[model samples]
Target: MARSLKNPKKRKNKGSKKGGGASSSSIPSLPTKVWQPGVDKLEEGEELQCDPSAYNSLHAFHIGWPCLSFDILHDQLGLIRTGFPQTVYCIAGTQAEKAPWNYIGVFKLSKISGKRRDLVPKRHDDDGDGDDDMDSESSSDDEEEGGEGESQPPVLQLHKVAHEGGVNRIRAMAQNPHICASWADTGRVQIWDLSADLNALAESEADVSTGGSTLLSRAPLIKFGGHKDEGYALDWSPLVSGRLLSGDCKNCIYLWEPSSSATWNVDPSPFIGHTASVEDLQWSPTEPDVFASCSVDWTIAIWDARRGKSPAAVIKAHKADVNVISWNRLASCMIASGSDDGTFSIHDLRQLQGDSRVAHFEYHKLPITSIEWSPHEPSTLAVSSADNQLTIWDLSLEKDEEEEAEFKAQIKEKVDVPEDLPPQLLFVHQGQKDLKELHWHGQIPGMLMSTAADGFNILMPSNIENTLPSENS
Candidate 1:
C-alpha cells in the first residue's frame, strides 16, 4: 500500500538537477532528473528539489539539543496499526556541549495523518476528467472529517530528566518500555525507571508541564562503573526479559542479568573477543542465548552465553571499523553490518565458516552511522550515514531489464532516473545533517523516525510496496 501527503510544505533542495533548462533541437527534453548526493555536484543556478508527492507524511521537529541516539519505544497501542492519524513515543539522549546541560528526553508525537498518493498511478492518456473530479471531492470530504486534527499541526509532548553526563548511547528494555539504560560519557552506565514520567505523559492530554520539566536528580536504580573506558555499544535481548550486553572501548563486553525488579547482577568476568573497541551489539531474535558484536578490529563475532567468554565463531567482516550491526528479526540467520567506510553487508550466519556474506553495497560516500531491518518487512532495511542521507533498501528486489525499460518509458517524461542507480534502492531521504541513528516504528508498518545534528524527522514514504498479513492468517 502506498501513502500520500496532506498539506505538504514546500522545501528547497541545496543542489538538485534542474528540471527546466534550455536544450538544443537535437536533444530530447528530460523534465525531471534523479540526483545522487555525493556523486552529483550542483551546477550554478541549480537548486535541490523536494518532490512533495513522494511523501505520505513528513514532519520535522527539534528538542533544544541534538541527540546522537534514540529508541522508538514499544507502546501499549495495538501491535499492528495501519490507521492514521497516528501517535508514537521515543526516548533520546543528548549531545550537549556541556555535560551539565545534557538531559534525557522522552517524546510523544501525535496527530500524524495524511492522504497517500495512488499506489498504481492513473494513466496519463486516460480520458477520465469527470471521474477524477468526483474522486478528488470524495477524498476531500474524507480528509475534512477524519483528518480535522491533522490541520492543527502534529503535537509534541516532551518529558525530560537530568543526567550526570552526556549520554553516549541509550536503549529501552523490549519487555518494559519504562525501564531504560544509558551509557554516559563519564564512563558509567545508569539504569532509570521512568514509570512515573511515562504515566504523567500518558494521563495528560495537554502540553506537558515544564514547571517541573527538569526532573529532580533522583538516584538511578543501579549505577555501574565496571568498564575501564566508556563505549557506545548497547542492547537488550528481546527474547529474554531484562537481559543486556554493554561493550566498551577497551574491547570487553559485559552481560547483565535481571537479579530483581530494580537491580541487575553484572558479572565481573567480561566476554572478551574483539581485539579493538567494540562498536555495536545485537542479540539474536530466535535464540536467546546467541548474540553478535562488531568492532574497530574489523571483525564480527558470534557468541553463545553458556559457552563462557570465547566467541562461537568470528568473521573478518570489513576493511574499516565495523561500526554497527542489525540482526534480522524475521530471518534468524541473516545479519547486517555497517562499517566506518560507507559500505554495508548482509551475512548468513549459517555459512559463517565458508563465504558467509550474502551481499555487499558501497553506496554511501561517508561512514555508515546506523542501520536496522524493518520490523514488518523481512527483506527491507534502513541505513543512516554521516553524509546526511537516510536510505531504504529492499534486498529482495533484483534488476530486470524489461521492467526497467518499461518503467523508464512510463516516467521518462516525469523523471530522468539514472541508469547506474542500483535497482534495489527504494528511497533516499535528505535534509537532516550528520544523521546519527534511525529506527522503524514497531507498531506502524511504514513509519520511520531519525535523529541527527539538526533534529528529528518522522516520515512515511509514499511509494513503498507494503504487504500486510490477513487477520485470519
Candidate 2:
C-alpha cells in the first residue's frame, strides 16, 4: 500500500544544568537539521522522519512469511517503460518457522503511482504563504475523498506452492523467467516451472482463493541432493536458458547442464576453488561460459564451465567474509562485491592481476546482504545492508568544489546538512528492517524492489535525475 510521510517538525533540544548552572530559559533553540543515516547519531528520544517529497513513488506490501531472497521477473510489460502507474512481477522464497510451512511465492504489484517531484515542490511550506499551505492541504483532502488516489490501492496478487524446507536462495533465468532454481535449507537444489501460477495471476479476474491453502503441493521438475551440506549460493546462467550453478557450505560448486525442457544433468565433479563456504554466485553477463563467485574465505573467483574445476583467476576481495557479488551487464568488465564488514567494492576485470579495485565504500555499518548493478544505467548500482538501509550510488559521480558550494547555498536556509557525506551517494532508503535482498527491475528504469524481515518495498526516488526519458526522446 502507498504510505504517507508526515511533515517533520523541528526538534528542540532543551538545555540542562552545566558546571556554571546555566538556566534552561536562556538557551535558544538550535537550527533544524537534516538527519544523515550513517553519519548522524540519533539522541535517546529522537526518531527518523521520512520526507515524502524525496520520492517520486513509494509502496509497501507483505507476504505471510519473511522472504530471504527474491528475483524481479522480466515481464510482458514493455521495456524502457517511462510512464507512471507501473506494474511489476516478482518471485520469492520464504523463510517460514517450519519446513513444511514454507512455500514459493509468486506475486504481482500494480498501479504504483504518486506525485512527480517536478510537478509538486515541497508541500510543507508554500513560500512563506500560510493560506497557500492551507489551500494545498484542502485540495489534497478533496482528492482523497473523491475516490481518486486512494480508491484503487496498489493491488497485490499472490500464489504459493508448498515446499519441504526454507529457501536459502532463489533465481529466475533471464531468458525465461518462468523457469526458476531454488536452494533449500534441506541441502537440496530444485528446479520449478511457475508458468501455471504466473499465468493465473496475470488474469484480470484471478481467483485469490484458488491459491495459498487451496493449492496442492507440487513436486519440483528436477531435484538434486548431491551436495553434502546445505548451501545459499545459486544462479542461472544469463547466457544459457537452463544452465545453472550451485555451491554449498563445504566449498563445493556443482554445474547443472540442461538435458531437456524439464530435466538437467548434474555433473558429479564439483568446481575446485574457494576454501570456505561459497556465499554467492553471479553468471557473467557477457560471457557464455564464465561466472563469478564470492566466499567466506574473503576472495572472489572467476571460472569457466569448460575449463575444468579450477578458477581462471581469483582476486583477494575483502577483509571479512565476502557475502555477495554483482556483475555489471552494461559494463561487463566491472564487478561489485559486498562483504560481512559492511564494505562494498567495485573492480575492473581487465586489470585483475594488479590493483584492480576501482572504488570501495564503507558507509554501511553492518554486513552487506545484497548488491546489484543497474541494468539500465552502467554507472549506477544499489546496495542493501543488515543495517536496515538501502543505498544507491553512481560510480561516475565526483566531488566538485564549485557545485558543492552552490548546492549548499541553495538549501542552507531550509536544511542543515553535514559536509562529510560522500558526494556519490545519490539516495538513502530507510524504514525497512533487516533487509535481506534487493533487485532492480530489468524493464523499468530506476524501479527497485527489496525484501526484508518485515515485508517488501517498491520505490522510485525523485532525486535520481533523468531516470525517465522524455516523450519525444
Candidate 3:
C-alpha cells in the first residue's frame, strides 16, 4: 500500500467512483422543499411581507404639493412609444412655513424606469491651429466687439425653474398636436417646445428691467387686459397659431393676436358677452370658427368668431353657476358643461331646440370643479369635484340598462362569468377632502391624472400591457 500510494496517478482503485467522486446511484438525495402560494412566513409581532414583484406592478402614490390647485399636461409622443407612458407635466404652488406663496415648480412624473435628468450644454474648448483658427477667433472677437455681427448669439434653451412665488393655476394649449403652451399665475405664459424640451419651459424676459443672463427667456406673444381679478381661463384658437382667448373675473373675455406692425403691439381684441365673472372658456376642437364660454350667471354661451354681440345660443340648462365647459373631441355637435349645483349636462348643438338635454350626469356630492372628455375614447368622460373624487363615465353605457336582460346576457358572454357578478369599479385616489382638477392623458385614453387639495395622483387602466391585442386572437 505504501508503494502504491507513491504511484497513485498510474493506478485506479476498484471502489473508486465513476466520476472520481461518490457514485450518483449511491448518493442520498435530500427532500425538496416546495413553497405553497399564499403561505405567510413571519416572526412574532412582525408585519406580513407582501410580494415585492406584485407591488412593483402596481404604480400608485401621492406626490404632495401645497396650495392645492395644479394642472397636468399629458405627453402625447411618449404614449405612442411606450404602452401607456405615464409622463405628465405638473405645475404646483410652493409654500414655506408662514412665508407667502411665491414659488412655482414644474415636475415631470418619474416613471418606473428612473427619474428624469436634464441635459445641459457644455462649453467647447478650442486648440490653436493655422490661419483658419486665427481667422475664426478674429471674426468671433469682432462680433463681440461690435455687439452684433455675422456671428450668432448662443441659442436660448428652456430650463424648468422654480419661481420664488408659487403658481396658483395653469392653462395649457397644444400648438400642434404634439407641442404645448402653459400659462401660470406669475403673469407668464410659457410655450413649452414639446418636441425635445418637454422638461424645459421658456419664460419671456422682456419685462425685466435689470437681470443677469438666463438660459431661458419668455416673450409675451400676447398681453391681455380688462379684469382686475386674476385670469380664470385661457383657450387657443384651434384654427390660428397666434390667436388666443382668455377670460377674467370681471365678466369679460378678450381675443389676443400678435401685432401686424413693425413695432409689435400686444393689444388684444375684446369679446364681451358674460354678465357675471367668466369661469371657463373652450374653443370648439372641431369647429375653429365657433367657441363657448361659461360663467357664474348660470349660462353657457356659444359664440361666433366672425361677430360677437350676443351668443348664438344660450344654454340656460343649469340651475346654478356654470363652472366648466368642454367640447367633445369625437362629436363636433356635442358639448358638456358642469355646474356648481353638483350636476353635469351633455348638450347636442344640433338639437338645441325646445327644452332638450341630450344627457345629464348627476353623481358628485359637491360642485363639479372641472370636466374633460377622453381624447382617446369619445364616449367616455371624466369630472372632478370639490367632494374629493374623480369619476369616469361611459356615455355609451346606459345606466337604465343595468337591469336589462340583453345587457346581462352581453356581459356574461363577454366576461364568461355569472350574470350576478358585480361590475368592476375604477376608483381614483382623492387623498384630501377636495379635488381641484382632473386631466386625462391625451395619448393614452384610459389613463388619467388628478391634483387635489393634498397632492397629485395618477390612474391607469387595470391591464395596460394588453392594450392592443391581436384582432384574430
Pairs with steric clashes in candidate 2: none
RMSD (Cα, Å) for all candidates, in order, is: 6.8, 8.7, 24.1
Give the least accurate 10-residue stretch of model 3, judged by summed lDDT: 15-24
- State the lDDT of candidate 1 residue by residue for 186-279, as single tens digits: 8898899988778877777676532345654667899999999988999999999999999999999999999999999999999998899999
Ranking by lDDT: 1, 2, 3
Candidate 2 residue-wise lDDT, 1-473, digit = tens: 00111111111111110011001111135434655555667676655555555665677676667778889999987767756667788888877766777889887877666544433334555376443542243445223222365424467778887877888888998888998999998999999999998897788544343124343488899999999999989999888889899999899999999999889999999997899999899899889899999999999999988899999999999999999999999999999999999999999999987977989998898899999998888999999988878889998989999999976876665567777878889888887766789999887777788877666778777666555563322
Which residue segments of model 2 deviate by more than 4 Å?
Answer: 1-32, 37-41, 119-152, 205-215, 467-473
List the candidates' TM-scores in order: 0.88, 0.86, 0.62
lDDT of 3 by residue, 96-173 (tens): 232232333344553322111111112236743332431233333223222343322112222333333234345544
lDDT of 3 at 397: 61
Query: Which candidate, 1 or 2, would have the higher TM-score against the true structure?
Result: 1
User: Which stretches in model 3 have alpha-carbon errors above 4 Å?
Assistant: 1-64, 67-86, 90-101, 113-168, 176-225, 259-269, 399-430, 463-473
* TM-score of candidate 1 against the unseen true structure: 0.88
What is the Å distance of residue 226 in model 3 from its true position?
3.9
